[model samples]
Structures are given as C-alpha cells and as structure tokens.
Target: METELLSYAFSGLLVIVFFISIALAFRFSDGHVRLRKRLKSRLIYGLPVGSMITIVTVLAVYLFLQGGIHDWDNPVVHPFRSWSYFYPTGTVASGFAHGSPSHLTSNLTTTLILAPIAEYIWGHYPDGQGGTNASRDQPWYRYPIIRACVLFPGAAFVIAVLTGAFSLGSVIGFSGVVFAFGGFAVVYYPIITVVGLLVVGVVRTILDGLVEPISFAGVTSTLPGWTSTAVQGHGLGFLIGVLLGITLLYHRNKRPRIFELFVALLIYGLTRGLWQIYRPLGGNEFVLYRALGVSVVLIGAVLVTATVVASKRPLFEGSSVTQREAGVISLVAILAFLIGPGIVTNLVIIDYHDEPADDELAVEDYIIGYDENAENPTEFVFDAPGTDETIERTSSGVYVASDQRQLWIMDTSQNQLRSTGTADIQIGGIGWRETVTAERDGLQVLGAQSVYAVELRHDDQLVTAYESNASTANIRIDNRSISFAPDIDDRFTITVEGSDGVEETASIPSVNESVEIGGIMFRASETNGTKFISAERDGTVTTVAQEE
Candidate 1:
C-alpha cells in the first residue's frame, strides 16, 4: 500500500474498534424504561443491525484479505460458508490485509453516515397515541428505536450486496445509502420538486465516487473526463440519485397512476434519444432508441392530455381535484415533459458531438527522449559551457530531467540498469538496493520485490541511506555534501549548510537545471522553486536569480 494511504489508516482502525465496542456494550440502565431509551439513542442508527451486518461483512473481508485474495474476480468463499459446515471459529490470516488507511476510512465512514438516517426512517413503531394535529400541516409518525435498529442496516446491507459493492474491494464509501435515500426521496418529489431534485443530485454525486460508470447504451459517461479528475463514482452516484429522485416522486404521489408511470418512461426515453446524438450509439441502436423515445413520449403526452381533460369535475367543487381531472392534467404534463426533456437533451448533444475525449492531451510544448542504445541505458547527460545554468555542484556530476513527465536516471557510473519506477525492492539478507519508482508497480512479487540489490553479509546489517526531500535529478559535489537542482538547467537556488557551519548557495543562470549537495541529491520536480525551460529539450533552464 502507498504511504499516503497508510497515513490515514489509524483512524479507520479506530472506527472498526468503536463498532465492536458498541456491539458488546450491555444495556444495563436504572430501569427497563431508562435502559430502553438509553440503548435506543446510543445505537440510534440501528447500530445493532449495522454492527451485525458490518461485522459479518468485515469478517468475510478479513478472511479474503488474510488469504491474500485482493482481486475480486478470483472468488474466495469467506468463513461464513465454512462456519456452517467446515470449522467453528473459522480462519484468521496472519497479516493485516484490509488494504491502506484510505480504504478503511471509506468503508467505515459509509456506515457511520448512512446508518443513522436509515434507522430513523425505519423507526415507525407507533405508541398508539396520535400527537396534536389540530389543523395539521404535517402528519406524525412515532419513532421506534428498535424497529429502526433492525431495518436501516438491513436495508444498507441489501443495497450494498445488490450493487456488488461491499464484496469488491474497489468501492469503500457510504454512497450506497445516499443512493437509497435519493431513491426513497423520489417517492415524495412533486411537493418540493426543486429541493427534491437538488438533494437527489447531491446524493448521486457523492455516491458516484465509488461505483462503476453508468454504461447505458447511449450514455458515454464523459462526466469523469470533464472534471479532469478521476471521480467516476460521483457520476454513478448521481445517476442512482436520479432514480432516487424518481422514487421519491412516486412515493409522494402515493400509488403512482399507471398512465403517469408510462409518461415518466416517455420522458426518460426522449431524453435518452437526445443523448444518443453525441454519444456512441451502435448502428441501428441510435435510430431504434430515438424511435422508441419519440413514440413513447407522443403516446404518454396524448394519454396525459386525455386524462386531464376528462377529469374536469370536482363533486365538492374547490375542495380538491377530482381523479378524472388530475388524470387529464397529468396527460397534458406528460406531453410537455416529452417535448422538454428532449430539447434540453439535444442541446447537450450539440455541445458534446464532434468533441474529443475529455482526456485528450492539451499541452502546447513537450520533449520526450529514451535510451538511444536501449541496452544498458541508466542515465542521460547534457553539458553546455556557455549556458550559465549554474547548477550547485563542487565537482560536476550527472543531472537528469524531472517534472516534465519521463524520468531517465542514467547510472553514468558503469551503465548498469538499477531499476524502473514500478518495481518493488526486496530486502532479505544484508544488502544495498538501488530502485526507482515509475508509473505503476511493475514487479508485484510477494513481500518486497527488489529493483536492484547489493551484497550484505548479515541479515540485520545496517545500510545507511539518505531519503531525498526532493526527487533525485542530479548529484553535485560540495565540500562534503551533494545537492540537486530541478532539471538540466534550472535557476531554483539550493543552499547547503555544511557541518562546519559554513553555508554555500549556488544559482544556475540558464541551462543547468540540476546539481547535488554533499551526499544528498534532490529529485527535479521537488527541487525547491524549479521550473523547466520553455524548450524542454533545449538542454538547459534559465536561472534569473533575485541577486543577479
């Protein structure tokens, strides 16, 4: 796991421990009434239910992790199946395999956030006494803590399982419940339609952060690329949110009129048709989809209009709308809906059509190079005397480019290929290791995979090595230390304070981007205040120092 992720793991473990503590907590209060109330509020979000579900989920996951089964495709039946037949206490894998800290946080937070709200909703065990509702604005429902404790977490488990989310290690967030909330809200959307819609969008975006992209026929899912950030989960969440919104709408209406259901479908179809123009719709798929949309909308509109027009009479006039009139109004609304969604959709089509992928390269200038020999290519060097790219070096050492993408650390010493970016460096017996991290993990062997190795006689032999504060661009010799600059020729000043209390600062004017100090070499990108030249391959960067 990455170090950054590990940094956040402690908090995640705390959450897990917290849940276990809650489950074991005995409800021993002053009396039965007091005990009931106390336990109810404490585990307010159906903690018992959530804890039970999450414990099972966590245990199953622990088994997979312990068994070294990280990938989802390779099915590893967890202990639950085994407990029923094979073993009693099941199994426990030695090493911690719940992934990094970020992973833990994501999963834990999901439950903490969603459980309470879901439980609150499910707590409808009425006390058989109606609260004051003289001229009622809102109906009252009793909050039954126990019932909520049972259902909310149960619902969450069901959602998580159906989505194939909890089983897979990829998604680790509470967005599923958020989606369910949106779905639930859809049942009451018409009353506060705008607020309802916004809520749905917010929920969708939050959940989408952890799910697969919506892969409908015409929906290309350009949402991620558009953000220039990898948050496809939000897009998925948002889509689920849309379904939630619809659900809320349905619920508010209370037993959806069949005609209205068809109308809603019509609106969806028309919108989809408009989406197809910009997105990839296979051969007859486009025409077929558009035809369906158009047809559905037209039928829905006509039906709605007929219903609204036919239901013109309220027997007790002005008290409320008659069912027949409401139907006619719905029919008219459907006609309008069929036309409106497609119009807005068509506009989106115009915006997206003829456009390239969101991830298309937009850089104006760039420089790319590789090992010419392609055999034992370790380091790359550039030397220009006139270019006053004053790299801070007592004695001239090699400097390679950094930051502007590709990194080629040439072992100018003996042309030995130390390691690439993604290889894991394994350490067994005493030995020195030379390794560099590239794009992804190339060597994923068990334990620590070695990028390069040097002989160390004993197992615990200590090898003194310096971890650079910055990326290692080049090495420069000071009296005793080595320093580095940003690139081949960068003016980013690096100042070194020697052991003798003497400070020496060097400034490269142009073309000499990197240099070392004492024994430490700073990587180019992280070299303080360094920037690459406009002509990246122009061999040097200009150093315009404050003094000069």
Candidate 2:
C-alpha cells in the first residue's frame, strides 16, 4: 500500500515538473542561442529527432511484421520476446523497439528535453561567466557523432548483459539511453542535470520497490505493472553516463597536483563503491561497507564540484589533449567500468561454491521424457497440465496439488491424497488469477487462486502444517514466515512456525485499523471505494492503494 502512495506522489510531482519545465523552457527560449543555432542542425537535433523517427519507423515495421499494430499472434517478432536481440543484435534493435505507444512517448519526451540540452553543452555553449574558455576548439570526441557512437553501444551492451544475466523476461526501450543523456548533462551542466536525474532516479526506485514479484524457475520476475520494465537498467545507464563524464575530466588534463589526483581517484572509487552498495546483482551489505560507500560518494561529489568551480586551476591540469588520445581513454574507461562487475560477480560465485543450476537441480525433476541435442539439450517435465490443475514437488519427494475448489496433498511414500477446502475462484482473464510455488528441503509453499498451502517433507511423507485462504495480490515467503493480506479483509496475517515446528498465525489489522507488523504500524482505510494501506516504518509513514 505504501508503494502505491509513493507512485501517486511521484506521478503528481512529474505533472507539476512537466508544467514548470514548459514555462522555464519558453522563458529561456527568448532567442539567445547563437552557439546552439550555429551548430549543424543534425548535431543539435540528431539524438532527439532521430530517436523519435526511429521509434516510429520501428513501430511501422513491427506492425508489418506481425500483420497489424495490435497483433500479438507472433510474439517471436516482438523485440522484447525475441532472443535474437538479447545479445549481439542488441546494438541494432534495443533502442528502436518499444513495448507500447506510451513507452515510446516517454522515451521521446525525455530524449527531446535532455538530449538537446546535453548537445548544446557538448557544442561548447559559452556560459559567459566562465573561468576557462570551454569554447576552446572542441575535440573530435566532443562531436555529437563520436559521443553517440560511444554512448549508444556502451549503454545498449550494458542493458543487454544485465537483463540476460538477471532477468527472465526481456525488455526493450530507450529509458537507458535517455538516462545516458541525463548522465552527460550532469558533468557538463551539473546543477540542472544532477537535480533532474536525481528526481527521476528517486521516483523510479520508489516504484520498483513497491511492486510484487513472481518467482518462476528459480528466478524472480516482477509482475508487469506501471513501472517494472527496466528499473535496474536505468540505474546502470545513468552510471555509465556519469563514468564517461568523469573520464572526460581526466582526458582534458594529464598533469595534476597530488591533491587533485587524489580527489580524482577518490571520485572514481566512490562512484564504483556506491554501485557496489546497490549494484544490479545483490551484494551483501555490511553496515561498514554501506556507510563508507555513501560517505566517499558525498565527499567525491563535493570535491568534484569544487574542482569544476575552480576550473582555472583544475585538478587534472594539463596543457591540452588530442582527439585520438581522448577517444581511446574514453573507450577504455567505459569498457573497464562495464567489465569490473562481471569479474567481481564471477569471483564471488566461485568463492561461495555456487553453481548456476544448484537451485533448479535441488527442485526434484518429474521428467517424463527427454530430447537430446548436441548444442542445447531439453528435458520434458510432467505436471498436472490443465487450467485447473497445477502440481509442484519438493526435493524430498512430496507433491502439492492446487486445483479448482479444493487443495490436494499427495504423499509419495504412501501414495495417498488428502484434500482440503480452498477459496480457489473460477476467474477468467490473464491477470485474474496467478500462482507462485517455492520449495526447500522440508518445505513447499504454493500460492494460487487466493489460497496458500504449506507442505512439510517428512521421510517421503507430506504433512500439511497450514492451509488457508487469503489475497493473492500480495503473498510473500521468507524462510519459515509467510506474510499476506486478504483481498476482502481489512487485515493481513503472518504465519510463522514456532520452535516446535507448529504453525501459528498472527493477524494484524489493516491500514484502516492502525496495526503493527514487523515493527511497521499502519492504518487500512477506504476512501471513495478505493482501499488505502498506510504503513509507518522507521519513523516514515507511507500510504498506497491496496491492489486487489
């Protein structure tokens, strides 16, 4: 519920900002852009105008490929569903393909607003009140083409690898590329760019945190909603842009004072360290590491600001930089930044003695047949295949069955079936019903049709510890604790197994009733038929619309 409120608040903030930007844009457009107007029209508008044109062209091609604009009959032709673009093809298709009209428009809007601003800065817009003449003949790397060449490939590659590695579903949009524009703007126009990107980042982070995720094949994919696509990709894209900006600072000057070099190194390290704390792949966050990461970034930002402000006696002070040298440095820096995380991830996985297939292998395979292939082998697995029957098994050889109107448990040891009443509704439509199953050695939990069941594995015997009906809108399992709220009720329940292995339930009043769970006190209420859940945790009160 808190998540929903944050979404509304962020949306409201964007609407307000949208109007403010319009007013500011017109106010600033009082015809004083000699430098901007002087640049080649293509250099000034290529990214903004070209990107929009490409989006529309791709949409037209997509319609032709699928026989209609709304034709989803052949999802293989859809960029987001196609495996071809998940890798090398990423360079060609990722930027042009968008999921919907709104998706395309959002990217177009941001690109139009931020890209032109960045292009002007790259064109060396004379700010009049400058210490050093940024108007000094710009290098080739500073040209729009070179910057796009570097930014597009770098951003696309990063997004592709990240989604391929961590995400089960595919994503295709220009959000990541739009973020790169914001990134370039930050170093070139710190005040405006930083503030703008920060607001966007915060809003996106809040939305990502609020959504419920579906666990499938040992991977958690967020259920499609208002703000789930490419959430982490935005973070990565923005990070890449910032890294490029920092590289440019060093490229401008080779010789520097000891203190200046120290500051530069500090900024670089802190930028990396900050990502370490909240990187795409989850990292263990020891308190000390997190604190130091944040502290370094803050200090680095201050030093960077100071250095930029004192441009005459800059930290990386050198006579001049050649175009080729700057380009090489930029390429190396971007590649290294993208590669470092992969190296660390591999090392960490190896150190922890973890294998990629451990989780899936642990889940018992109820295979009925197998298809052999030299390149990629396939195993045909069996389950109760029907709209109403879905079966899952545990590593300990117990099967839990969820069907319409009743829940069934079958013991492999005795080959017996136990049935219990369930609130499994006969709902129609794709989003109407959902199911998620998770398992451990002695535990298997199935959530479906607004009901959840827990099966305890005991010597090939399945023991039903708890079975109940609740809302499927929000169901979560952490170790032995299960948390959920019923769609029809005003309270949520937390069922935790005690030391004796017996299940106990605790019901906390919903947001309207003002109750506390896990130290978060909230009130559940209805306003004009819309249910809202407000939760207070760590002295912050967050209210959100309850999703049913």
By TM-score, who's the top model here? 2
Alpha-carbon deviation at 412 in model 2, angstroms: 28
lDDT of 1 by residue, 142-163 (tens): 2333333444545555554323
Clashing pairs in 2: 1-544, 5-544, 510-524, 511-523, 511-524, 512-523, 512-524, 512-525
Native-referenced Cα lDDT, model 1: 0.31
Mark the regions of model 2 whose C-alpha exceeds 4 Å error after superposition.
Answer: 1-68, 71-107, 124-172, 195-236, 246-548
The residue-by-residue lDDT of candidate 2 on 1-548, one tens digit each, is 87567666766776677679878987888553654444444343323333334345545544543233443322212222212221234224444455554455556555555665555544422222222323348665544544444544444445534433322123466666666666556655555554454455454443443332221266554422322444334545655565555555555542234454444434434432332332221111112345754664565455444443343332244636544344434445644554443322211100111221211111121111111111111111221122111112211223222112112222221111112221111111111222122221111123333333333432343334333454322332232333453222323454444335566545545435765444445466777754555546567664522423
Q: Which ten residues in a row have the lowest lDDT in candidate 2?
A: 367-376
**Candidate 1: where is the Cα deviation over 4 Å?**
1-99, 124-150, 165-174, 182-548
